[model samples]
Every structure is written in structure tokens, then in C-alpha cells.
Target: MAAVSRWPENVVVFLYAVFFFHTFSSAQRDPGYTFMHQATTAPIVSYYDYIIVGGGTAGCPLAATLSQNSSVLLLERGGSPYGNTNITDLAAFGVALSDLSPTSPAQRFVSEDGVVSARARVLGGGSCLNAGFYSRAGHDYVRLAGWDARLVNESYQWVEKVVAFQPQMKQWQSAVRDGLVEAGIRPYNGFTYDHMYGTKVGGTIFDQNGHRHTAADLLQYANPSGLTVLLHAPVHQILFNNQEGSKPKAHGVIFMDANGLSHRAYLNRGPNNEVIVSSGALGSPQLLMFSGIGPKEQLDAHNIPVLLDQPLVGLGMSDNPMNAVFVPSPQPVEVSLIEVVGITHNGTYIEAASGENFASGTRTRDYGMFSPRIGQLSTLPPKQRTQEAIDKAVEDMQALPQSAFLGGFILEKIMGPVSTGHLELTSRSPNDNPLVTFNYFKEPEDLQRCVDGMKIIENVIESNSFSSFRFHYLSIVTLLNMTASSPINLLPKHANASRSLEQFCKDTVMTIWHFHGGCVVGRVVDHDYKVMGIDSLRVIDGSTFRNSPGTNPQASVMMLGRYMGVKMLRQRST
Candidate 1:
């Protein structure tokens, strides 16, 4: 009685033509606003002098600057990067990061020590899955986050006058800006976005025909009759009230939509109504440790209900540790991604990205500019990691030879390492995915500053103005043999090849995903980004970054959502 197998009629007609073009396609677009669909039951406006929660990249410029005089809302849990084309096609950036589907505006995840990323479930979060490099936010990170260096340069020119640009530098990003001034990384300041120190040329959100431009196109400065947004919704918590202990405010949120129902909204009672969040840095500390706020014994070991012990809600996480050096090129260049940046006064930040015409059934040919040791060799389980140690590291990275010009370079150390990491709560399900660690190189001076940023990318590939490309420095100790049982001496006939290049930087370190501190600012938000003991709440993106600003944090997270929407419209007009 257990024999009903079937399927192969051309795999059931290619699974009914992929469920009839994803159930009769043509829907998702509309970022125009007044948008709805949390499976529409209408009613929803219970209040909202401001709400916001994650339309992403700092909730679409802080809900289009608090909808120009209050009444906002926003919401957004994916769906609507206005006409997706794998997010408006900038060479379909590896088909929007290898589309893991669930409506893919790049949401993959993975972590518990197996580090795989891809965050941004649409609505321009991580500027719709990053690489649209833009700089600024390093005047010692605005005098160590005391900000207001003239309103952070007027919120970096109001998000660089609608999603920045100025790139056009081809030929392998002008040989990585003349190999970072032939690796001396000196004064070639040029086209600045001002993080200064050396070879520049920043700002880019793709335009000039490459086409990206997100942060939901800054909701074209909202106020569409005081914004509303909604989309697939999803919030699921943060509706606090707490009386017996005083302080707990954040009066409303619950969420769920896209036909999962549940709604709620709230906020407009007064005293400057609030709720911000801008979900990022692993979703604003996993939605503030799933609303009860964190570390009260990891939110009572995930049984949840704490309300606010706030042990630094998801602690000081930090990322930016990259180290790639691929270089294939034999001809076909163009098709790029970050343009000319080298910043290094000994804290390394060099960058380069051009993967030449890669749109053939994308996974961008298993795009590996570091960070994919199959999530660190699938963190040990899987029958104790056999399968011939993952097919001899994928046959030694597919025995090299396959290139129609493949140049890629990323060497980010992004400032002296102080190493910090944390973010917990494995479950209490706001749709799970939480435990991220980034304890990368657990501070041995962050593996000698990522082996001094891989000897400044081996001195920009032994420059001579990058001698007409043609390259090959695979080496992460021959691409991860990791200097066979390293008991010292690691090549250059050892005289301490910097302790075998710090054990080949602990087997090729990763994450240049520039993740900032988890709800940080003076540790869980304060310096005007609110959230500390939670009242009207706040968090305006890059998880209120009190640290990672050495560079590429999506133009300092859209200048912290336009400097917290001009300091919440000057504290709601006083």
C-alpha cells in the first residue's frame, strides 16, 4: 500500500510550468505608496503618528522623513523593490544573490557558526542586497558618534541627492585605481565621498544604466498624503506597554499580513509618537530580542516574555573582515560593482568588483570572493564531515582554468580590530533565524589585521599599475590547505612569514558585509537614536552603529536614515 510514486512526465510538465509562472505573475511592483496587501481586510489605520519598522535601508529614509509632518506607518516585509527583475538588474548581481526564493529579494540567512548571509527581504534593505558601494561617515565616524558634524553633512546630502552615482570607471575599475597608487595608498583623493586617507572615488547606487537605486528610491520624499506603505507586513511583536515597572512604552506593532492576518499598528497618542527600528544588523537585534528586549538569560532561554533586562540587546556585533583576491581575467572586463576605493592608513579597505558578463543561469558561477567554506565546512555534523572533505575542496576550486576575464578583489580590514560579536535567541520564532556570531578570528588583533589586509592584497598584485591584469593569487595557503598542520613557518621560507600569515588568516576570513553593532550607539541605542530603556523606542538602522563605519555601510546607512529624519523632525516640532 505504500507505492504511489509518479512525477516524470517531464517532471510533471516542469512542475506545471513552475506553478504557472508563480501563480500568474504580474503583481508585486508598486512602491508608489498608499500600497497595501497584508492580505487586505481593509480597516488597519488604528493610529500612526510614525511606526516605520523596516521598509529597510533605514526604513526608506525614515519613512520618507516621517511622512513630512507625522502620520507615517511603513512596515514592509519584502515584496516591492518595484518590479524586482532580481532587484532592478545591475547585471542581476548574481541573480539577486542566488535567489533562495521565499519571494527572493535576497533572504538566505544560515549563521549558527556556519556563516552564510544574504539579508534584505526587499524594500531596499541593505540597499537591496548591497555592493552598490558608497562611502562617507568616517570623520572619525563623526567624532566617535557624537554626530551632528553639521547634521552629518546634512545627512550626506540628503542621501546623495536621491541614491548617489558618479562611477563610470571601467577597465577593471581603472586597475583598482592604479593598484591603489601602486600600493602606497596615497593621495589620489579624486572623486570623494570623503572617508579619506588615500585613493578614492566613491558613491554609487548603480545608475548610469547599470540601474539599481534603492532605499525605495527614498520613497521619493514621501508625504504622499502622509505615507502608509504596508506590503507583506510581518512585524510580530514590539507592542509593549508595561505598567507595574513604569518606563516601557513602545505602544504598538504585532503585524503578520500577506494573508497571515494578525494586524495592530498603534502609536499616535502623543508625547511625540514613535516606534522606528529600521530593522538591520541581523534585523535590529532580531527585533529587539523578539520584543521582550534581550539577554535576560537570552530572553528566558527563548521562552520569551521578559520586557526589558536589555543586556545590550544582542550585544556589540561587528563585521567587516573580508579577504579575497581572485583575479582570472583574460579579456572580458566591464560588468562591475564597487569602484575605486583604497583608503588604507594601515587599517586596510581596498576594494574591487567586476565579474564581467555573468548572466548565464547565475549563481554568478558560484561567486566566491571569500566566505563560503560551505559555511565553514558545514560546522561538523553531516556524518562527521566526510564526503571526502567536501570533494577535496571542490576539486581544488575547480582546478582553476576557466576564465573569460574574471577579476574580483576585496580586501577589507576596515580599521583596527577590536573584535566584538553577539546576537542570540535561537528561537521564539519571529520566524527563527537568529544566533549569528561573527566572532571571526576572535581578536588576535583580528588575525593580525587580517594578515595586514593580506599584505595589502599582496601589494596590489605586485603592481606596475597592475601590469595589464592577467592574474592568479589563489593562496589562502593554496586555497585552504591552510598550511598543513602549521607548527610555525608558513612559506617565504619562513623567518616567521608573519606566523604563517596568521595561519593563513584563520582559513580565509570573511564577512565584508559591513554589519555594525547590534542596536548600538551607547550600547542598545541612546545618542538620540533612542531605545535604551525603551519609551517611544527608536533604532534607525545599521543597528544604530556605534562602530563599523570605516567604510561601505551603504553611505552610513543613508546617513542614518537622514540623520534620524532630521532628528525626528526636530523632536516633532518641539
Candidate 2:
């Protein structure tokens, strides 16, 4: 027989007991109101008072509010974010964005103009994937959009209570804050959720422990008995009842379950029973076009029946163009994102974030615009541009030795781009991604604004406070010279420096992912968010914004959702 173990008998017994409890107690408790993935055995009912497509940043909150007195079915294409460490942990931020898996929360797509971007496919929408920065929509923006000022304020409070937090600024973010003030963006407003002109620290969704509190957390307000959230439920089509000489009514939706099983949920016969499409900027427009609600000519070409000849459904798309100057630091800095923001007087917004070395093994995705694969200046198929950019990025990374620590100071010019883009159907299939042409810098003024923004960033980096950081400015001129659009002068002293800057803008400008205005309030939807020429359907997401809010949009999007939900509730009551 083997010699008797000398370990304490009580310890051995305790370990065995713990192992047994762990194995059995791991079974999740039914929260009753909690989410259910497609693989689950719970049957989706055939009808509900309201069916919300896309359980995203807007949809989650909207669904919860609507469910207060109505039976609501919230359908989401992606799975829940509960246990996804890639999304919940701030340290894994890049990992979540870079994930190319089919079930990744971030869905990677290439625009028609060859720009690569990833849209949120998971619940909580972009909130699950973004840098977790939060800011209110500008008061001017609220007024311009025709939103009720009082209601919008209340909506912000509703959301802030659940997800917003005041961030404790660390070494790097603190330095950036002082630098922005020194660079002339002054009268530091301190920490606030209000979007104001000047340097200020905004709210963040990340807690002090670096845990992300997503918009999904707002679902806690949901009426458990009235709400049913189905994950992995991709809504393919909005079931409509078209009658002769009458408006097309959205009665239900056809979505696929986790097992690829088809399911349909229809609205109750009540007059107020309706369907709301809160699918995000790209998704809401794509779904509208798919449901034959876009340009008549484009829909005809795709051989789809037109429900509403709404030419503006997928048009007027725009995104904030971002040009980043990377400053490599000699020592490791604390990881942060969008803590201190500088709202420049010159229609620009300068923000700084600290990140790990881009060349580090942990960062698998090629994120920078000048990345060799995606940044190469070549006349290639539009679809190949993103791949090429990635490849070029990889090549550049291969040349750099992995550093122990790298700090990044990013500049984002959030304003003054009048140029707009559009989204069109590449195919009639719902699974086929849309052709998104951001048409960035199509206007000369837009390019000039970007150049001015870049100059401001250079000044901030050269400021006395930031000098101790030992910064090495990555020159846009040198990068442009290497690209196909090379042989251009970007030096400040050059006579045609503006022109060179324009060329550089064309070569290197990429999206900061602040996309908006595909479905304008006045054109596509009314002040109440009701879709024009259609009954019982509304679009209540970023796509409905009349213009970009000149700040991070998560807070605005959530506020809109809450505002719309309250409006609908009051209407139903009356």
C-alpha cells in the first residue's frame, strides 16, 4: 500500500467538499428577468405587445422602459455580455476589438471606400466594445435635433445612475489633463457629464477596479414578467402588412434563433402595440434598406419591393475623422482611455489615452491607420483595402522590437467636417454587409480642419508639461512620402503646406467611429421618432441623429432611448 499522506485530514476533507459544491453550485440561478441565449430550451412566445429589434445600447434601455406596462420582446443578434471577460475587463479592451471570431462581440466589416471598422454585434452594442467614455450630447445638439430639453435632461440622469462613474485620474491621464489646459483649452470644468467647451473629465463606464458597467446593466430596471430578452436572435426582416392604398404597418419580425431555427413574434392587436428598431447606426439603416425602406432606385436594382421610397434612409452617413500622432514613452504608463478631453476653440476636440506598446505580443490586431497592410497607397479593390492596411500594419510591427512600455497620446478632431458619406446594400441578403463610403475629406475645408487639428496636437505634445514624457512625434509628412500619395511636403514652412497637409489627410485620416446621420430626424423619422410613411415603427438610435453630437455618443444614444421610451409610454397612456 502507498504510504499514508501526511497532509491534514481536515484540509483534505474540506478540499473534497469544496470541489463537490463547486461542481454542482456552478449551475446558474434563473434570474427570471435575466437574458436567455438561443441554445436554451425556453420557447420564444409567438406574440408580444412590443418587439424591439437589436438589444443594443439604445434597445436595452428602451426595452426595459417599455416593458414597465407592456409585454416586450428584445431580440439581439449576438450573445449576452455577462461572462465575456474580453468585454468586462478593461485590460482586455484591445482583445475584444481585435477578435475576428464569428461570435465576437465586435463584427469586423470593410467599408465601400476600403476603410475597416468593427460594429458591435453583442448586447449593449458599442457600449460593450468602445473605450467606455461617457459624455452628454451638447445642449446645442439637443435643441438642434428638436428633442425636448427637459426630457433629455431627465433621460441622462436615468442612465447615469445605472452606468456612469467618475474616474479617478492616474499619472498619465492627469498629465494629459494639465497639458490640454496649458495648450489653451482652459478653465478646467472638473469632472462632469455635461458636454462643454474646454478641458474636462467626463464620466466613464469603467469602475475603479477596471470593471466595465455596460448599458446592459440598465436592464435591471426591466419588469421581469414583462420582458423577454433572447440572445443570438438575429432579426432578418421586419414583417410588414402591406395593404392597398394604406400605409405599410410593421406587425412583427422574423428572426433566427441560436440553433438557426426561425421564429416570429408579432405585436398585439392594440392600436399602440408597435415595433421599434434600435439597431445601431449601421444596423438600423441596413435593416431599413433590407425592408425596402430606402432609395427606390437602389432597392429596384437589388430586385426588392419598395415599401417606402425613402431616399434618405441610408444616405447622409458621416463619421468623425481621426488622425493620431503616437508618442512612444521610455517607461510603462498606466492604462487609460479618454479621461481628459480638450474641446478646442477651433472646431476640434483633442483627447489623450494611454495604451500598451502597439508592437507587444498581446496586441494582435493592426489598429493604426498607417499600418502598412491597410495604409498602403495602392489602387486595389475596395474590399482589399482593409486587408492591405492590416498587412502593412503587420510589416511595420515586425520591424519594431517589442518594447517593455509604450505610452500613447491620441488626438481626435471631432468637428468641422462637412463632408458626408452613404451606406448602400451590397446585396439583398441580410447577412451581406452594406457598402459604407465615409467619403472623408471630400471637401477641402474638411481636410484643412484636420490639418489644423494636427497642428494643435503637435503643440500640446511640445508643451512644457508633456516634455518630461520624452515624446517622439510620428511625422505625418514622412508617412505620406512613403505612401503612394508620397512626394508631398508637410513641413510647416513649406509654401504649399496646406496642399501637402490635404494630401496627408487623404492618405492617413481614419474614423474615430463617431458615425451618425444616416437616418435624420426630419427626413427619415419625425420629432417623436416615428418612421415617416410607416405605421407602428420607429428608429431610435444614433442613426436618427441629425448630426454628430461633437462628443462620445453612448450617453446621447442612451438618453434618446429613455426619452423615446417615455414618449411612447405617455402616448400609450393618453
Candidate 3:
């Protein structure tokens, strides 16, 4: 709307050419990977049959699937996951999450409730950052979502054939499985991708060689010539055509490249041509608000013009609260993420991971980036505090070990967390994380479920199969027990005195990162994931799910992209 600043084309080309080629070495194996380019090279104006913003977990598969029949454009804010050892190598898993540097593949954000979490910033999205556990949504979740069952299964098969794998059962995982069954969690279901209430071995995205296969790998199925993926392209807003007598329609989108230069991409004028937002649960809602499609009051406060005054745009958010006990192993345990899991009938899930550098990856001092022109801020922090304070904080952070180290095992994670919260934009910038709170255990029912789950974990920890790995000597028992203060402190001495357990649940609540909703179905979007009262637009990511799909959602999420892409293609043909 104002004077447009432009970079000289030659300088733009030269700057990006140097940064682009050298960064994508790890991704060179994928044939379609060559199609990726820095957003700076994107044309000033372009048209596509579909413009999918956020080249993330769901976005990648959706783009690849749709490109088979239509021209598709995928815009991602982060660069390729390639050459990032923290993302690709399974052993180096937590490195990016703890890096916290501006260039890290996973960006850290703290909730208002004080739980620190990471948002995926690489092209493969959370798959590039997570523990790589893969499991399908339970039959109940599928039935509740009102999806076509056959199609959903087919979609799962489609994604699993490429990215999902049967992980080799390692020593630590096998013991955990035995302990869960010994604790009476369920009948052993052996290896399965289906979500069933039992101790079962699920799928993983990591191969035998420990190389992670993220959703980006699904691009191999794409019609390469028809798909254009631009990295370092963050969308600014969704452009709309507000015809006097018609509903507000998403027509195009404006995105900024690496240089912050704006480029516009529009949909081909067809009823079916659409713009999809697959920018995760938090990002999708934030994007909608930034694009002027959320609560009127909030938009007004942010000085953003409202095109559609949807009241529930960022409502009904929930992140499954995960509680864990670090059990130190006397012998070296095999390094593993979640390979074995116990799915309880009471709606809580149990899983474990061992041998990660829980202290986070060790980093060199020249990691972080900052601002205010402090003469080339090399080791600066993102906050505005003094350099001394940040240096101390970084030193403490590097020293901190959130989980057990030296081959210790973590009996971790509980799912559901029916407790909900909401997201509201702090500023109009899409890059800024919105104010969010999971409101963990706010509901009485949610608190009860957590108590029930913790009791199960107590049984598992006390079981014979698990005892061999734990320290038994009373001299050091208190230190090695689930809590340093008391062994099985989550349980009440008097059976019905549950208040202490409930308090413990509140005090130590953390996220398993299975958060979903915000642009929830029936509230923000319809059954088809079309945003209420909006046309030629849809929000199709974890944000639309009323519940987290399975033990882990990446598999279900990737499946959703393929499922919906095929459905849309069918709709177009009809």
C-alpha cells in the first residue's frame, strides 16, 4: 500500500546463490529437492492452481500429492532440513531443540504458563525435530473426526510405505515393553501401526541407520515439474476479494523472502482453486489472525483490518501434558527414542526414550544472534537483557540436564490433556509467537486422568522388568527414585487422599507437544476444514483436529495431507 522497496536483481541473485547451494547438500539425494530455491529468487508475481502456505509436516505431503494433478506452490519460512545433523541424525535429536540459536532448525518459545517448547522451523517441520515416533490415530479418533474410514486407512498406508518404518526392537525398549505388560497395561499386541489399547511396538520415522525420514521425503511422490517449493518464504497475509454480494474469498497471498522483499502469488480463477494453511496448530491460528480473520476485538487492538470476524479463531487449544520419571541405568542403555508404547484404556499413553544428550547438545559460544546494532552481535541472546546476564543464562542452560544422562532411561509422556487454552496475537508479525497457554489440568476430569496415568507409571517403575535398571540401595534410593523427595510420591498413602497427587500433576506439568485445535473443526473450520464464512480457503493441519490423533501425530498428520489432497482432486474432477 506504500512505496515498494526493491533489491537490485543481480545483488539478490548473487547473495542467495552463495547461501542456497552450500546449504542443501544433505537433501541432494531427493530428485525433487533441486526444485527448492530461496524465496528471494521467486518471481515478483506468480499464479498457481493452489498456494499452500507453510511447507511443514502436513504441508509437504499435501503439496506433493496435489502437484500430481495441479500446479502447486509451497511457501516455507525456514530453509531445507538438509545438512542439519541435529535434524537428520537420530543420535543428535535434541541438539536443535536446545540450540535456541536464531539459525537452529527448531525455534524455542515459552508458554505463558512457563513451559518451554520448540516450534519447527525447518522444511520437514516437526518431523525434523521430534523423537520420530509414528502411530496411527485410534479407531475412535478417526470415527469422531467423521473421516471416511477406508480413505483414512489408505492414506496411512500411502504415507507409511515411504516414510514410516518398523524400528528394530532395542534392549531398552524391549525391557520397557516387558515392564508395561508386567504392570498389567494390556495384552501384548506385538508390532502394529494401528492405535490399540495395549503394549505395542509402533512405527518410527528413523531408519535402521538412524537417518530420519521426514514428510519432506514424501515429495519424491510429487510431480516435480508441477510443484514449486520456496524456502525462507514467510507469508505476510492472505489476500482477499471482498465482492459486495459474496463471501470474503482468499485469492492470493503475499510472502516475504530472505531479504524481506514481498512477492505475491495468486490462485488461478477457478471455484476449486484454493489457498491452504498447514502451518501447525499454533501457527495456523496465528496466521489467520495476522491475515485479519480472527476475533474482531483482538484484530482491532492489533490495528489489523478484519475481513471476517470469527470469534473462535484461536480457541480450544490443548497440548497433551506429559509427566516423566528419569530412571538411571547401571549399565549403558541403547540410545533410542519412543519405539515401544503402552496405550491404556483410560485415555493416557505411556512411552520412553533413552540415551539422548538430555543436557541438550553442547554448543560453541558463537551460536546465538541478536539486534540493536551492538557492532556485530555474535554471541548475543534474543532477549534485551545485558550480555552478562545472557552469558550466565547460557552457561546454566548448557549445564542443565532436564533428563537423565549417561545411558539413563526416561519413562515419559501421557496423552489427552483435555484441558484447553487459547492463542492471541501479541503483534501483527507472523514470525512472533502468539501468547499461548495450555491451561494444563484446568479441568477436574483432566486432573483425574493425569492422576490415573501417574499411578500406572508407578506400577511400571516398581515392576520387576524395570527394577533391574533402577538403583536399589537405600543409601542412594531417594536420589535415584522418581522424585528426590519421596519414592512414588505421586501416590497417596491413604488410597482416596488424591489431593497430593493432583497438586503434583499441576506443579510438574509439561508438554508432549501433541497440542491441537485453535482453528478447531465446527468452531473455526467446517468438517471439510474450510474456515467458517470464508471461500477458496482452508486451514488443514493439526490446528483443525479436535483431539490429538494417536500416541504421536506426525503419521496421522502426514496421512491427513495425502487423504485431503486426494479428496480435493476427486472433487475437482466431479
Per-candidate TM-scores read 0.34, 0.87, 0.86
**Model 3: residues with Cα > 4 Å off, grouped in runs:** 1-32, 356-404, 407-412, 474-497
Model 2 scores a C-alpha lDDT of 0.75
Q: After superposition, how far is residue 444 of candidate 1 from its true place, in Å?
A: 12
Better lDDT candidate (2, 3): 3
Q: What is the lDDT of candidate 1?
A: 0.69
Give lDDT tens digits, candidate 1, residues 421-471: 788877755555677776767777667776777777777766777656754
TM-score, structure 3 vs. true? 0.86
Decreasing lDDT order of the candidates: 3, 2, 1
What is the C-alpha local distance difference test score of candidate 3? 0.77
Give the runs in model 2 whose Cα sits over 4 Å from its true position: 1-35, 39-45, 357-389, 395-399, 471-496
Tell how far residue 271 is off in model 1, in angstroms: 25
* Full-model lDDT for every candidate: 0.69, 0.75, 0.77
Clashes of each: 3, 12, 0
Per-model RMSD to reference: 21.2, 5.3, 10.7
Which prediction has the highest TM-score against the true structure?
Answer: 2
Screening candidate 3 with a backbone cut-off below 3 angstroms (N, C-alpha, C), the clashing residue pairs are none
